[model samples]
Target chain A: MELICPAGTPAALRSAIEAGADAVYCGFNDETNARNFPGLNFSRDELRKGIAFAHDRGARILVAINTFPRASATALWQRAVDDAVEAGADALIVADIGLMDYVARRHPNQRLHVSVQAAAANPDVIAFYVETFRARRVVLPRVLSVVEIAEIIRETTCETEVFVFGGLCVMAEGRCSLSSYATGKSPNMQGVCSPASHVAYEETAQGTTSRLGGFTINRFAPQEAAGYPTLCKGRFSTALGDGYIFEDPVSLDATTLLRGLQSAGVAALKIEGRQRGRAYIESVVRHFRRALDTLEDGSEADIVSLKPFTEGQASTLGAYRKTWR
Target chain B: MSHSSVASRPLPTIPPLLTLAIRPLPLLPLQLVLGGFLQRILRRNPGLLDRLGEHRYARFGIKPVDLPFAFIVEAAPPRLLVVRELPQGLDARVSTSLANLLALVEGRVDGDALMFSRQLGIEGNMEAVLALRNAIDDAGLDLPGELASLFGPLGEPARRSFELARDRLTGPPEEER
Candidate 1:
């Protein structure tokens, strides 16, 4: 199986490749991609250079143009598709159906992989994307069990990819609006969820409270590990109790399930975090590469502990386990 | 020390005698030297502060727990002040070892990983801290190289000395060891 990694910058792209990434995915330094954070992503020239660097090393580059375009500003998204293709991206990971249609029609021979933002969970939807857009692969959302993933793979003709490590989004991909409700920016539209510009941390008498757009997301006592102010992973006071209402602060780690995913015929294993630094990219990619290599050698991979890179210093298998529900 | 006290106390990585030796040093001279260095860096990389955006206004307290003094950096109307005690009302404070701080500046160590390992402690505005981290990472500052460039004829020697001192003081990164 392929080990796809993330690159927020040219340096990170180099680090991922050096650490044994079979393919590296990145986006333009704009809203064209999901990780459109300030000081992250690539300029057009950087993307072109990064693709050349990867290609020279026999690794592929996948460009993400996954955000939905505004009706009035469809040209911007269309331009991104054209530029990504012009930059010689191995594949275009797209989410918006309209954008996918544009890519299919405009660049008929270019490889297309449906982004997880599309939330293409089941076989029928995956098949539709394969037939309509001629999408060669579909990144399955983080809301599937190993059994469910196998079922989808069994029925769908397109290749399948699963997120093996990094941030875990509890809400359905491409459909979450909680961030927009609080910050007026959604990942699907603005390519940023709980954007740092709108996030604030305050040291109060109670402890440290993380607030997003004037609303408290989570609070930590002295010395407790703090998490990023993601809306879905925020703590809340429901009628029953004052604690994590939606999901706890944890990162996705499916290292143990590599064998299961491979058995289920996963085409690629993805490491999420294009917003992360090169150190993170290097370490995580190296660790996963070792794990995948060990698995190929027909032995259980002795996965290194990745707690330090995880959110809240905790890792969960996420929805990959049936017991997660 | 208790777990609660970890944030305030110096990490055990530093020799206690080294911290004791640093305690007697006057702050004013260090402050002036660091202030000049900050200006030189800003002049060299003008776009560095721009990456912080509105966060440039925030006061960032950089506490190298192993060191005797801390630095409060203000990106807007730029200032870098060394103080024996961290003043109240700073927008954010990040506590870690001096080695980690230098490594972070060079993008050698990941901030999230440091935080996850409980080696880095951050208080107050996370957004501002994140902005500062991103800005610094994007700038890709090389302190040794910057210091070396300051001296035209003795550039190589200055860089060599600085790197030697850094290696002697901090040793190799934990991963390398």
Candidate 2:
């Protein structure tokens, strides 16, 4: 399988390209892109430059115009698609049916992929995007197991990609409204999740507890590891008692499952940290590239070596093995 | 909208005392706390955070922003900062209102309230946010001592939680020798 990577900005794009990513996906710094946090993404001109940068290096750039267009502001999204085509984007990753309709009709030449945020878990939905938008690929949600992924692959001809090393979402992608529930903003509409704006950390006499908005998400002692404040995974209390009702603070690591993913007919493996630095990108891209190479020879990869690159210095095979109780 | 996003503060000079005092207060880690602070700052300052392009924090080792779009910071001293080089022609100055920003950094605000409201801005390229983030992470954030909201009844339920945190933690205060 090829390696698909995330480039939150032009710098990240170049970093990924230089680090050995077969292809890099990024979004404009607007609602059009799904990772719509404050300090991530590129502008139109930057996209042009980024595309040229990738092409010049024999790499590919996939522009993510994935957000659903609002009825009141359809023109803005239309302009984004226009700009992407004008900039010579290699592919357009989209989720909304309306936006996909616009792109497929307006720029039939543009390659289209389904954004995982759409949460199209079943073959019927995945095939729906492929048939409806002529999507060439579909980024599968994290909820599916390896067996499930193989089943989907068997049922469709669409090229499939799975998140190999990076953050993991326990909930179905695109279907989550947790961030919106916590902060009026959500990944679907606002392009932010557990938005940085709502996160808080306080230090007092006892220990450190991470809070999102005013809600206590997780509390940890000084010696314990700390992860970024993704609200869904936070440890908390409710009328039902205290637990990570959503998830724990563990990242998804599919390094050990690379051979299986490739055999299951996945066309690409993705690493998901556009918010990370170049150093992190370079290390992850290089390690995965090497692992995939090792698999070409049917040998077990040194998957443990990529530990430092994992978010929070930890990683797991996630649902691939169903180890969680 | 974060204070430091627009505030012209110097390099880090955390006294270690601040972090130590935070332990017993039933607070979260700094990573989680910083987001609410940044959001609150954005709300009060409005476009001031984008104004960093026009104004440079020389003390913080940041480059002087000369972006086409300029943002202002209605900070403590009221400065006109610019977010130079961006293609957007949006010009914003800091709103000079910071009750919310200060409150967030102080751990007085709630997470649910932040998402459920319209308090931040997205006037320019979102990609620049990362560079802006780099600047923030690079900046030496010395959180102000506006932590009055941490006491009282809401503070009682977490006493055991606090004890667990305190007992489990090791090492002396960050600043103490």
* Candidate number achieving the greatest TM-score relative to the actual structure: 1
Off by over 4 Å in 1: A299-303, B1-17, B39-60, B74-79, B84-93, B116-128, B151-161, B164-171
Compute the lDDT of residue B156 as modeled in candidate 1: 95
Best by DockQ: 1
lDDT of each: 0.84, 0.62
Per-residue accuracy of model 2 over A172-266 as CA lDDT, tens digit each: 78778777887787777657777766766554555556676677888766445556667777877789998778777666778778878988999
**lDDT (C-alpha) at residue B102 in model 1:** 72
Give the share of true interchain contacts found in each model. Answer: 0.33, 0.07
lDDT of 2 by residue, B1-177 (tens): 111111111112223565455435432343244334444444454333442342322111111111112233333233333333223243221111133232222222211122112121222222233334432332222233111123345444444454343223321121122
TM-score per model over all chains: 0.89, 0.68
Model 1, A255-288: lDDT tens digits are 9999999999999999998877766787788889
Alpha carbon deviation, residue B22, candidate 2 (Å) = 27
For model 2, the superposed segments whose C-alpha errors exceed 4 Å read: A238-241, A298-304, B1-131, B135-177
Clashes of each: 0, 62
